[model samples]
Target: MDDQTRLELEAAAFRRLQKHLMEDRTDVQNIDMMNLAGFCRNCLGRWYQEAAAERGIEMSKDEGREAFYGMPYADWKANYQTDSTPEQQSAFKESFAKNVENQTP
Candidate 1:
């Protein structure tokens, strides 16, 4: 496919994934996702913010999160976020350090 077509496809897939997480699968905890998948909704929002910066769009982290979640981060957390277990937190810290924090920029 052409470049534009490829970008469109990727954007569509991202939107679908966002919808799946933010709407369809709200029960999935971010900590569990970080532990198992090494990324979560916040990571996705950060990526969006980075992409905007790359293009000189000047987006903030909160703005990117609002774009991704279709609402403020606090609101989403209040409405959909569930409390994670101690085990999940421990695994998330390990997984995040290994999978994300240690990676080269």
Candidate 2:
């Protein structure tokens, strides 16, 4: 495939993933995703911010998050977030260390 086609395909896939996470699987907590997958909706938002930066678009973290979550981060938390257990927190710490720490945003 050509470059434009590849980019379009990738963007479509990302949109699908966002829909899956935001709409189809609202019950999946960010902490659990972080612990198991080493990334979550927040990470997707951060990446959106970074991508805007690459294109010289000034997007704040909150703006990126809103764009991804289809609402404010606080609202998403209120609507869908659950309290993490001690075990989940511990696993998140390890996962963050292994998967996120030292990575430049």
Candidate 3:
């Protein structure tokens, strides 16, 4: 496939993943996703922000999150986020250390 087609396909896949998480699976907590998959919706937003920076677009973290979540982060938390159990928090610490702490941006 050509470069434009590849980019479109990747964007479509990302949109599908976003829909799956935001619309289809609202019950999946961010902390659990971090523990299990090492990334979550917030991470996706951060990546979106970073990509905008790379292209000279000025997008704040909150803006990126709103763009991805389709609402304010606080609102999303109020609506969908649940408190993490101690076990989940512990696992998140280890997972974050392994997957996110050492990464250099």
lDDT for each candidate structure: 0.89, 0.93, 0.94
Q: Candidate 3 at 30: error in angstroms? A: 0.6
* Model 1 stretches with alpha carbons more than 4 Å out: none
Q: Candidate 3, which segments miss by more than 4 Å at Cα?
A: none
lDDT of 2 at 40: 93
Tens-digit lDDT track of model 2 for 65-95: 9999999999999999988999999999999
lDDT of 1 at 102: 94
Candidate that scores best on TM-score: 3
TM-score for each model: 0.92, 0.94, 0.95
Segments in model 2 whose C-alpha atoms lie over 4 Å from true places: none
lDDT string for model 1 (1-105, tens) is 999999999989988999899889999988888888888999899888888998999999999999888999999999988888888888988999997799764
Candidate order, TM-score descending: 3, 2, 1
Give per-residue CA lDDT, model 3, range 84-103, as digits (tens): 88999999999999888977
